[model samples]
Target chain A: TKISQPWKTTITTDESVTPWEDATQYNNFYEFGFGKSDPAKYADRLKTEPWSIEISGEVSKPGTLHLEDLVAPNQLEERIYRFRCVEAWSMVVPWLGFSLADLLKRFEPTADARFVQFETLFDPKQFPAQKSSSFPWPYMEGLRIDEAMNPLAFMAVGMYGKVLPNQNGAPIRLVVPWKYGFKSIKSIVKIRLVKEMPKTTWNMLQASEYGFYANVNPEVDHPRWSQKTERRLPSSLFTPNRIPTLKFNGYEEQVAYLYKDMDLRKFY
Target chain B: MLKSRWVKALLHIALLLPLLEECWQIWLLVNGMPNRLGPDPGKVILEDLATVAIWLLLLGLAITPAKQIFRINDLMRFRRMVGLYAFTYALLHLLSYLAFILGWDFSALWEDIIKRPYIIVGTLSLVILAALAATSYKAAMRFLGKRWKKLHQLVYPAVLLAILHEWWQAKEAFNEPLLHLVIASALLGYRLVLFFNKAFSGIKNQQSLRQTARKNS
Candidate 1:
């Protein structure tokens, strides 16, 4: 258990935020417990100091990077984007991040590297959600090599302008706005570049529920429910049911070309 | 026979009206008809219907327990009503999802059934709930008495499906579904514990009684 020592901000945020204390305070971090407020209630007691990420696999640099060292070089930029969960609910959040493209370039992924996999921080001692056999803990999500290299793919450090709250993946996380929320793995502690398609935690747990790409495409519906529509969250009980989900969550101009020749239905 | 005829007629009429109302509501939604219900028409309808269905099934399950625990035998009369409402709202959940969300397109709906896991669970829940609703009447119950209890066991699966459906669908925060699962688990757990306790005690009493009778003989 590494205790966090106060480190100077080598990388400054392009901006500052009021910080959503409540966002992390009120919700259940099911990754920790089943109670809705349990994660928030208990997460406050969590030790957030001295986090480190194990960078391995096909990467040229395979070593543990401290939280401070990992974030020291990157310049923070705020990208407010719409986050849509596969569950059909949605939320618009302003995330503070830098491009994953920049990070990958630093590691210099080999030409054979076909996929980038992120592993969430998964110590059973801290994250109780790992104990439950319902779904695997330290949730993992992956991206194709191109997808990971895409400028749109982000390695987020903060949300709503302030440093990330523990419940919302405090240290660092991925933000693929064009994909469903789960594709954005949180509290990442490991980054692996691999030659073959990496087995994502959710995909491995239930391949049918999550896919490798996991892109947000309304045209490609979820096997069980129509992804054509979504419920924007914080909605009142009487609010109308759904709004038509947009293609690539309306980011088609940036990402549509990547899947130009591939059939989304099959990939989905 | 005439009195029974009247009862049957009343049952048909009673079930028909709610079914029609649900259909009418769906039609209003599908045709882009005006609904002064809420800010987000589709979500408003879904949440409202979900709440109604959750409570309805809960009420349905409450009948037998209430009758046994509180001696509230009159609760039996509301069982059909609760089941019907559950069916009606679940239907609305499916329809509003199809017509409004999927724009009544078959291709999109088909893909959804094939592609999404949460949706698969949600759809299966609805199907099971629909089956339970389809056989709610006294005639069907009389025809499938023991089978009715067996069929209604599908309720357990349906409730779990509903919770998963809700949980998997949540966006950023998982407070609502997590809370719901905990409550549902507790309720279901209590019943399971009580069943074993009663079953074990019944066996013990029967064995002791048999022993006494054998000695007397």
Candidate 2:
């Protein structure tokens, strides 16, 4: 559970990091439950020690890798990225992880691997909310092949210079800085590289609201609410700390090239 | 039974608890005290007050039917306070949105109203409640005279609008909003049934009277 000799990365933000307490307590890990604090309250029941991620589909090295072996070789680095939720709130976190590209390279994805699909652990006994039929359990998400290999894409194992919290996607989680927070799936237990586009949880639940890309765009409004502005966390009542949302959540310079000529409005 | 000063006082205290609790929670929220109000306390405050307002509205609406069904005329004595309290909670809910959510940003609110139609629905409900609350007193009621009954009848639409507001805003998880819809339907449905019964019985009585008059002539 330790990130030994972690080094700071250059691709990071100077914005104020959301407090560790706030970052861990406030979560959208719906597997434990949907309430903001539900994950923090119930996530402790999850046994992360004996974790093994099954890597399969269009990968030469498709095998069950233990948590230690999966993360051992890569040199952990800190990344202070802006995380924006689809719900119009945001936070800055110092995430500790290695580049996802590095991990994907080790897996040796074949030519047919066009999309990478990730799935969370599906133990109903650990995550009580998984029993609810509202969501197809074992929360799933996918990234385009080119997008997956983006320099900003990270496989986070810890945040705020500590081990990743169970509530905040323990063991390991995908951190797609340019996309909406939900696009960055958590508590990953399965990794499958597929050809056709993979079905994501939110997109499956409501496609009109959540798209596969899920890039943070102020112009394309969510059907239910406006995504034009976001409330930065730890904002007081007097000072709402509202800021205009940015295209690709302020990572446009780094990741905008991935969506070159595609109609964002339609894709959104 | 409601005539007892002690009972009235107790009822008032019971009704005021949610307001006090909300005030306390907002205080903690503003001060950054560790609270269960979660990350977006402003949103929590806004949503909490709205729910409280709706609960009070439903309770106030139930008073007439509750009195008739239970034969407890004393319930009528508390209707005014309950209605006023409902209005108060709704007023706070609006303020919470402005102060906490919008930070008094009128432009943002205007944009939200334009983009999100549910805000308009909620605002309409608030306006109706405001009118009802203003005329809830004896002086205003007496001044309005016959028009008072007509003005008060707007409460039905006000409650319906509030329910619609909740339903419209509820995007995916609709269990709570669905419950509110059901409760409002049942309460309003009872009133509609009573209204029709009176109208139909009156028609039958008038027809019988006309037949009697013709025979006499």
Candidate 3:
């Protein structure tokens, strides 16, 4: 496999990258089960070898792209990003993937394509949690057309310089750096360019709590808990490495222009 | 069970097991051993300790009903110990949350209690548990007399509030919280049934006594 140049200059974070074991084991992937450790325990049943993404809706080139062909043309890069969860925890991760803009551009999106929607693979036989109706299965996430085109918007295939583990959305996944981690839908099976804002899973579940944009804004707190501060993971027992959450998750310089004139609090 | 000192000692150890387990995990974490406390060890420990407190509260609530239904007089001896342990764990749970989650920031903690309904509910439940614990001693029990029992009835509401706190805090999966709700409901339901049964039986006895007096007249 040909690897792209590392993104040392293009992207970086002052925070230390979370340990591989901690990042992989402690996750909130509801596809496996509700427990944080459930994904790592049960995700092995997922079949990633024969993976393909169906590119459809408002796109000139609408067809299924196999995993191999999807990555063959693009140069992979390690983008170290701070992943902030809506639950007020965070991890600095070194993700290996290409720019989402680079991938979406290949499909030739139409002028009517105002939004980009991504879908995760749904297999009850593989994902046991799919049996439960906690969420409308086949997790979906969306981004505005311009947001999708942002340089920070990534489509990750691997991390730690190795192919993604099954639990961490193997084969391929989306990584929107400025948004909450859940917006980066995992194990993507479909990409749709649509005219209207797509209904994302979390937003559909609770619109008041989870907005369509799902941007990392500390001021817009979740209905259940405060988002002003986040406990960075791998913290010590007594004192958690708590830090004040930044607006746009510290990516305001690049992504703020995209949301100009729009009320983030209202949209969020 | 209280008849034997050995049984009493064993019961105390059994009640302390949850706290002991938490200490063991902390030891393992400090010693750099592979422990069950995951990435956010503080959050994990705080949640586990809170759960332990709730479980003990539920067990303590079950003792009176179990004695009534099964004629297990022995169960009474363990009720006080279980109640005290629940209070101890609840206090520890609060401390853990303060130390780990809030980082001992009193201002933030106050804000959480005021702003967040779940935290408010949890705090109220802890307050009720504290009252019950303070009165659990023999001197307070004697001073309060019948009032002690009445004050301790607050446990029913406290447990319900604690369950609500658990339910409200849940983000996605509600199975565990729902299960806790079901258990708490069943315990309270049993008490209600006993109360109604005694009232109905008392009325029936009064009616029979009136009939006997009329026949004698």
Candidate 4:
């Protein structure tokens, strides 16, 4: 079924959109596998239907909410956001979703809810990579309450003016535009309102490299590779589309206030 | 024994195919046409070159062990050709990074080799390959004499460094890198076993010669 009213909004990049093929095909969904194309190839295994997300912890309303009913209250808006991967590749994608703040407010979180932790579907049968004990299963990510409530922080249900493909986090996913793409956890199955900071997947894997606040900062390089520049997707061999990466992925003016007092480098 | 010359010719044609395919992809990119290389052809090409370089390096390492096991002396001649091709691919891989990835930005290239452990490891492996390729000719072998053999032994470390480079680059995904490491271990392990066998049971050359001299007497 098609998404309801994915009308275009001003919250979009002026840059050219990454081709749907590239955006969908070239993915790092480790649940399916590690290869760039693995997710696209093996995503059929995921069962997005009969899907429900458990909203629990410090929220006033705690229950397993079916995906349809959860998405029913709000109007879906089209947002073309710039997605910058931690590996120094980037894409401009037109995502369809309602504001995350809109979704979180419905849950009626208590004052105790300082952090919001999200989890992906943990079914090893669907996610074959979960069979490997290399990474702690059930990919988890968290954002501070303020960060979660930020207007720019979106919960994408679809992209490219249609329902999100199973490989591209079908049904639901978070889209924190300012952070590196990994923080925008895919195929979310749980949203827990907790008091303490949550242990994130990549950060848990390598604390020295991926931090909790993976804000796209050009100055702050990943220990392994430079973040100063990114190869924009749909780029060919001779005509390179490598461009200088912008701070906060060019959304610095909008979201920089969220980390006003905190040093991004230290947090990153 | 299979003719090493014929094998070398076939190997050249086989290796040339991938490079030719890349060239076709490059042509497609230049002409602004759709290509199979994917969105970032430059990155894809860079990876392809690196993959070929490492595979060739591993194949070069496997030659001696394979020859020993199969008792095919003809296999020895192909090692130099394999080593040279491996160096060529490695050189092209680094060049691709400089040209496509960096856009000829020497500063970033310098910084990457100096600071980034993966790139540094990769560069070190390539440098060792370069040294081996430079000294592979007969004149260099004659000039260096016994030292040449000692220097060529650097192939073990060179291959290990390349594997380490691959491991460093492929951070979380250890499957492919681990497989490469296991293969390297097996190839290098065979040589170690032979060395230790000769050490413990006495050198085969002297022992065989003594038996032959006694038989003659």
**What Cα-based lDDT does every candidate model obtain?**
0.72, 0.90, 0.89, 0.89
Q: After superposition, how far is residue A148 of candidate 3 from its true place, in Å?
A: 1.1
Listed models, DockQ each: 0.13, 0.56, 0.71, 0.54
Interface RMSD, in order shown: 7.3, 1.6, 1.2, 1.8
Which digits, one per residue and each the tens of the lDDT, describe model 4 over residues A38-103?
A: 898899999999999999999888999899999989888888999999998999999999999999
Worst 10 residues of 1 chain B by lDDT: B35-44
Instruction: Give the C-alpha miss distance for residue A206 in model 2, angstroms.
Output: 1.9
Candidate maximizing lDDT: 2
Question: What lDDT tens digits, residue by residue, belong to model 2 across residues A149-236?
Answer: 9988999999888899999999899999889999988889999999999999889988988899999999999887899999999677
TM-score of each: 0.61, 0.93, 0.94, 0.92
lDDT at residue B29 of model 2 (Cα atoms): 71
- Ranking of all predicted structures according to lDDT, beginning with the best and ending with the worst: 2, 3, 4, 1
Clash pairs (backbone) in predicted model 2: none
Q: Which tens-of-lDDT digit does each residue in A168-259 have in candidate 3?
A: 88879998878998999999999999999998999988888899988999888888888888889988888888899999999999999998
Per-residue CA lDDT of candidate 1, range B1-217, in tens? 3235565567557655644665576577556564433223455455656766666666666667777788766656666776877878788877777654555667766766666677888888999988988888889999997989899888988988988888776543466677667767766776898999999999999999999999999
Better of 1 and 2 by TM-score: 2
Model 4 per-residue lDDT at A56: 96
User: Scored by Cα lDDT, where does model 2 land?
Assistant: 0.90
Spell out the clash pairs found in candidate 4: none
**Ranking by TM-score, best first?**
3, 2, 4, 1
Per-residue C-alpha lDDT of model 2 across residues B1-217, encoded as one tens digit per residue: 5789999899889988988998888787768686767767788888889998999999998999999999999889999999999999999999989998999999998889888899999999999999999899999989999999999989999999998899888756677788888988999999899999999999999999999999999
Best by TM-score: 3
